[model samples]
Target: MASKVGHPLRTLVAFFIVIAALYGLMAITKNWTPRLGLDLSGGTTITLTARNTTGKGGVSATSLEQARTIIQQRVDGLGVGESQVTTSGGNQIIVSAPNVQRDELIQQVGQTAELRFRAVYQQESTTPTSQPGNSATAGTGNAQGGSTPSAKASAGTGSASAGATASSTAKGNGRPGPALPTEPPAPPSPRPTAPGKGTPENKAVEWQPSQQDITDFASFTCPRDTQYYPDVSDQPLFTCNEAGTQKYLLGPTIIEGTHVTDANASIGQSGLGWQVNLSFDSTGSKQFEDATRALSQKQSPENAFAIVLDGTAVSVASVDQAIAGGSAMISGGGINQQSAQQLANVLKYGSLPLAFEISSVDTVSATLGGEQLQAGLIAGAVGLALVILFCFAYYRGLGVVVVASLTVAFATTYAMVVLLGASVGFALSLAGIAGAIVAIGITADSFVIYFARIRDEVGEGRGIRTAVETGWRRARQTILVADAVSLLSALILFILAIGSVKGFAFTLGLTTLIDIVVVFFFTKPLVTLLSRTKFYGNGHKFSGLDATHLGVTALPGGRRRAGTATRAATQTGGEA
Candidate 1:
């Protein structure tokens, strides 16, 4: 009699109950999905081939990974969600962000993030004249054609050119016009001396555009307007006047984004608002120092430099001295708590070592993916039906054991796949499905070994009830060895291979494990219990383990009688 503790159906039931509870938990925790590949989701894919710009064998894998980190930061800073950045073929980087406009993402990914400071001349006071109605307003200098004595302009009240609507019309000459005179008859203060032309009143000051001015400048879309505002045709060597309250003239960047070692955003000491702290490598530090020192000596506006990010002015600050420590802080009035945090994240991520190139990017319509999913299910169903049919034909009543064991294996495997998909980023790809199909054969082989062992025991004249126990003893060793070899092969495949082949190895390993568990916990117990039943114990002709087929006569009390020729002949003659 089979022990209750080892009964197959009971164990199977308990296993299923545990799995069901886990499934419930999985459902509550997160939505499961086999993450789709690039082809299945519409996205932008950029392939960047590495160029040895410095001829130092281009970049090492480590450096490339760092570059990826930086690029990821820039891309994510745009507020796009769940972007993918990976390396491919050793020297190429692939970037994909689903549903984002390709042009916008491309511009963000390609920037070399070089920030520089350039000083601009500033005066003490001025009047607004950029508007036609404001033309009547007054402030400092002569309101005549060129060659009028200059008037001082304050930091905030400049840019009063009549009808000059935040256009980039500045002639790039770095010259500031005299402020409008406040009183028309006061005769311009005995001609105040020019700042750098030897005047006691001339002191270098910070010049930045007002917040309203930066906002106006940000609204501009170049190439649609007059020739005075040329669109950024180059990689934007310079960001014109401040988009912040402190307007600055920026020269071309001397250090690229790749040289930045780290960047973080934090609140200043006063706890007022957000600011970004930046650090650069030795080479970048020297360049930054040169840029700042040159800009620091100029008068207001001319004494400040602009930090241009992706062709827009995010901040502009003046340097009081040459920042020799290779670090600096950028304080922007518009940056708030949340935005500052995101900027910090961007800078932190922009220094990892991952590179990849998209080999192809094509959209898989949702309808088509649905069709594919349906087809995969149908294929799985057909394969299962064929296995069941073949088992029934050859194994007869023994096929029930095969079917039961396989069902349990399938349940466990499915639950794991779903859970893994939810937990890790695992996805059910076409290759993964193929792996599962291959595993079915492996699972079936384990069942065949088990049943054949039972037949072998019965042929050795053991009673059906005894044969069940003896068969399991022999099968255990064989099953363990077979499973071990399969697992080892899977490990080898997993470690050495990449892409879809690894999926195949993974499924194979998982099913092999399930096969062993079923054999020990479900199959052996079921057969042992069934052996105690009347039909199986008596060795009925259709039971697939009948004593006649094995040349043994089943008797009561766990005994079997061997065939005797002489007795058989005498009995046959009497019957004749």
Candidate 2:
């Protein structure tokens, strides 16, 4: 197991190996690349139209735009990046996501988007450090917290679980993380209400939490996989941080997002990087000021308020002081230009006045798909070239081995992708291509690990042949462990992940296994064969395996960090 893994002459023409290589080479180039998904290739477009219910009035411009925003959010929930949703004419909203999950996405965009103001009552988290102002107590005092039953409701023919619709387009692809809740505010009592009903004075009543709310909060878990927009402003709301780190118990609707008349993302005047500025209408301003003031006075979790949308908490921060101006700014937590814009957009689109009905769903022609396919290929090619060039520039003679091994791995992987696509309906989406690109880094890292190990052996004064064997022994275990971890992660993501990201996980897992095979069967033996050459055995200065450049100095205990390894030639090639 130790020495044999690296042997060059272990077997000549292993029948199946040769046959598979020949067949793969012959079949892989059939189309050269795997099938592209809609984002990379043109796919279908869906058009949904908003129509007001009998008493709700006609679909006004404002209502149409709001419906578009909600529809966009639903299509975006899957995070395919290839999707596009826009409102055309007065009542038409269009969505262009890949046809792979088109039906599912269509149903998602048709639901309603509600805005809510829930007070942080009691919060709990298993994370080690409790955030300032967080309470883990259940139903203690007025602390309140609960979870969204679903992120969306079925608007049309088929209704998927709210979990299915609420899948986050954000990172983590919906993985679990823990978060602590903040300060205690008395749970608002349930008060019968009318939405947007009365003057600001009438909105002053706090809605209370029921026993069901307590049970819901207690059972609430970290990293909620699904979410639903709060349809009723008077109800206790339950939600988790996107990072899954913390949970919040929030009070009633103190301030509706409609209070925010305008929002913009920009760099802070105080040089605090990016921040979001919100301007409010008079009523909105007064209400926001009161809410912020209340939050500012509370303990940590209670001190912080969540800006939630469609069953998700987009942002949460503790108030530092009373924000009385009605206008406010949000900053902190590594918010950058892009993230700030995202925050602003979410806030801007969070509350839409209308819902939409799917008008028609249609497939886009494959005519323009090549552009995305080309882009994916272009990125992969560039990344591949850079890695290969770096190996040669740094490794010198050893660059030959690195390049060869990488080529084998690449060829094998591409062949498998194509073969799988042809036989098992494994279509390659943009995310899949990204996974392959990431694999390039993993592949390069494997070479780096092995080369470093070989250099270590040479540094100890071993001949090239001996170093190769010893290095293989030490490095093989590490490579196996790393590949095992990679495969495990891929398996989990492929199993648990939804939407295109799951395909990304599949590609990742597939390529990882290929790394193991190419490294063991191709990399090890190729290096062994090359070690027999004059340039390498003699430790030519340009050879990356040269002991001196590697800083191998022979130590007093027969140890050497770097040296001329003149005795390297005396060792038999397969001595190990």
Candidate 3:
């Protein structure tokens, strides 16, 4: 019976077709290179230790994992590719981002993300008064803060609008209160509260600044004074917007981040610029409705509510009328698509379950990363060279087959790595390089197994052409089982391991798959075609399969002299 090996020519064509498809995709994406990991491309690694703000005994695994996920989202917002955020030692979160600014990465991932909605009790410019004991004047400024010139609210549409460069001076009392203090007071006590805890009676309009609160507000300065005050839910907050151009005295938290169900950035209903639409849960909707109703009855700055994040006023929007819907929109001149999306992401992801203290920050320089990359490449090259050398020394002319198959497999693996990098943000780390090197041995082993099977058949009297098919039939199962085991191990490692080790498992599995592809489509077909050629089919001396080399009387299927078998047996016995 004839062994059924599929059409070699068609398989070879299909393999090339797949390669062409990969390159075609690369052309479409315009990304020809794989993304490098932090160790290879230089970046910052931040380690944060989680601490329960509620005075709990220890940080729970659930909270640490939740914090890691939130930090990952924040880092992803920065558009950094190949960023890694993982939990470690139960209470620590490790964040690695390649090619990111250190300060920016720290800011994004390190924020406590405590979001609160408070009524604006007072809004003032941070510009110092010209003379001592004089009231400071409000200056018109950009969206980050200063003075909003005008603000309009569409009653039930869940949208509010303010000028980008508007002066939002308090409407009723235009006089600034007191002279600014040259120095800020000592930091306030730690007044942390459960994220979303607040009562209905502590409405936005009800909380008035106490005598001490007024003193703190008078002495506070934008940017500098922010650190002194703790932004607790039930207490007043004195802080500035992110830009530090405007200062605000805010009432207790009216709504917390936990109540926000969803947020998205889009063009406003008025066809203005960008805005962030916020959705709230049932409790948040009721609280927002009540706050808006009361605030709409007040004057300009008093009518506006401050959207505070991490004790900083991100936005202060005035309400012209009651907004009773379960949704609200934040629109201002300074809110472009980028800022809107950023704000939306922060709100959408909500606050981390636990506060984190940055434990350590380590940065890898580009020069060091380049040096490490060069070392990894050198190691891989050395490994591949040794593999090729062994094949040539042992298999003679058959080494050419090994080299060609490896070349095809390498091309396939490179293309896949590049594609994966572009598509899914996969990065190649040094550990991943080690995995590829190990795969080199696995691939070479496959070729050795197939070739040995063919030699065994030829030694048993089968022609090379016939042996090609029979050898493949015998070797295919072992090759598949071996590759399958490698792939399985890689999958398990990838699932259980963290940090750079996952990179190793990823590349190992990727190369294992490419090994199977090359063996079935490229290597087997090439060997089958070579078996039909005169040089290999004739079992020439250099072909590594001659009768003399195999210790047989003559080439399989050829006539032998009467004494030839006797002489071959005698020589084989003498050599043994």
Candidate 4:
């Protein structure tokens, strides 16, 4: 079969064009550096063990996987680059993030993310009251400054009153009005009896605070008492918002988070600010409509409901009319894009199937990370130097091809890493670096195969040009098979491995692909072009393809002077 050679120059040009395009994209994105992983850069690593919240004995695989995915989404929502959330043991999840606060990381991933909607029985500011009855009303202070309160009544004070009639504010317009005192006075002797459980028609007014509940609400501070209340759907909750600014005594759960089907954050139709829109299932829709209808008829704070997450009030919005549809919007003074998006994410992903307990929190210092990175680079450099030395010592002039091919492969790999980092949050770790270093040998092996094949063809009495093509035909299959095996192994490893080992597998598979590109496009084309040169074609002594070096009688298809064959024979005999 005739050996078909490709358009070497065109292939070379196309390959370089692709490389140039990668760098161009990097420049456009303004991302000049690769995102390093937790090991390479200082970061926090947390290990979590999943336990079934119910009295189940062991964690199910499906539940653990679901928890990992939810936690991963939460981490990504934080915009932490190169964060990894992977399942380790049967019930354990390993989360690694570069350059993130430990407490923030824990708070984000540790929460069960249970969401609930509860009617606000009472609302009070956490700050100390100046007078006996003076206290900031719930939803009074503007999230954004304005003459009108965002959704609830503005700040005002009156004598202690339970369920006082405070005028309800419209969605976007409402002036400050006299509000019921947030702080309750000392309970009179024989405190009024708590309301009994009533029918659904008057359920909103049925659940009144007991004497204990009222006393606890008065003494309960913002953040100090926030964690004390466990979110039970049947019980009243005394807790504060995430910012610890306002505390609330909330009625029983009106709607559980499970009913929420979708949530998204976007600019309000009024274009005033960002708002989170929510959609609920059919059952939730009816329940919500009923709850809102009843709550809308009540006085100031009672008309407002709190969207609680993990026992903290995310937002409290007043209901002017019955929200009959399955959808609702949470928008107020403090609702910005970040807060809105975070709330949306929580509602969208809902709660995890199982609760996760943080087993260990590990922090890697920047200095130690830097030292490790430096050491890794030094080892890679030393290995590359040795490879270069071996290539030159063995292949002589042909070593130039090996060096050039390796350089192209290295450049292409680096550009890909940087581009992947910017586009897909792929971070390079120490294991990834080691994988790249190992690829040096893999790339060198390809050159060695091709070069050896070329030498065999030359020894079989073929001219340099013919041998170049024929040798490639023989070496191509071997190179492809070798790379395929390597890629398969990497794929398997990536699939089966956990933690940083996946980083290694990813880079290995990535470089293996780059090796194929460099060998087929850059290396072979350059070698083909070089073979057309007189020094190489004539098999000059220093060209690493001399007759003596190749163990051949003479250079095939080369001009010969008088007695050249005689001199070649004499030289071969003398060397023997």
Task: Judging by lDDT against the true structure, name the best candidate.
Answer: 3
Each prediction's Cα lDDT score? 0.53, 0.58, 0.72, 0.72
RMSD of each: 14.0, 20.4, 8.3, 8.7
Show model 4 residue runs off by greater than 4 Å: 1-7, 45-73, 76-96, 120-221, 224-230, 261-304, 318-362, 366-372, 452-463, 466-474, 545-552, 559-576
Model 4 is weakest, by summed lDDT over 10 consecutive residues, at 134-143
lDDT of 3 by residue, 138-189 (tens): 1221121111223346333243332122244321233454433446665444
- Candidate 4 lDDT, 473-545, residue by residue in tens: 9999999999999999999999898668888999999999999999999999988988877787677777776
Error of 4 at 461 (Å): 6.1
Backbone clash pairs for candidate 4 read: 143-333
Put down candidate 1 lDDT per residue, 64-127, tens digits, no spaces.
7767767766765654433567766667777766545665555455544433322332211112
Between candidates 1 and 2, which one is better according to lDDT?
2
List the candidates' TM-scores in order.
0.53, 0.43, 0.71, 0.71
Residue lDDT tens for model 2, 1-576 = 345533464632352385387466646556556655665555678777777642366789887876676656645534444355667888888877663455455435553434344444545443323332211111111101111122111112132111121212211112332332334534334433334542232243343345545545545555542332233454455666544455555555566677776666777655756766677779876676566555555443455455554444545544444556556655544567755655555555555565556678887766555666677789889988988888888998888877776776777777777666555446677778888888888877888888888887776556677777789999999999998999999999977876578779999998898888777777777777777777876677787766555665532123332234434423422122
Alpha-carbon RMSD, candidate 1 = 14.0
* lDDT of residue 456 for candidate 4: 77
Residue ranges of candidate 1 with Cα displaced over 4 Å: 1-10, 30-46, 49-379, 548-576
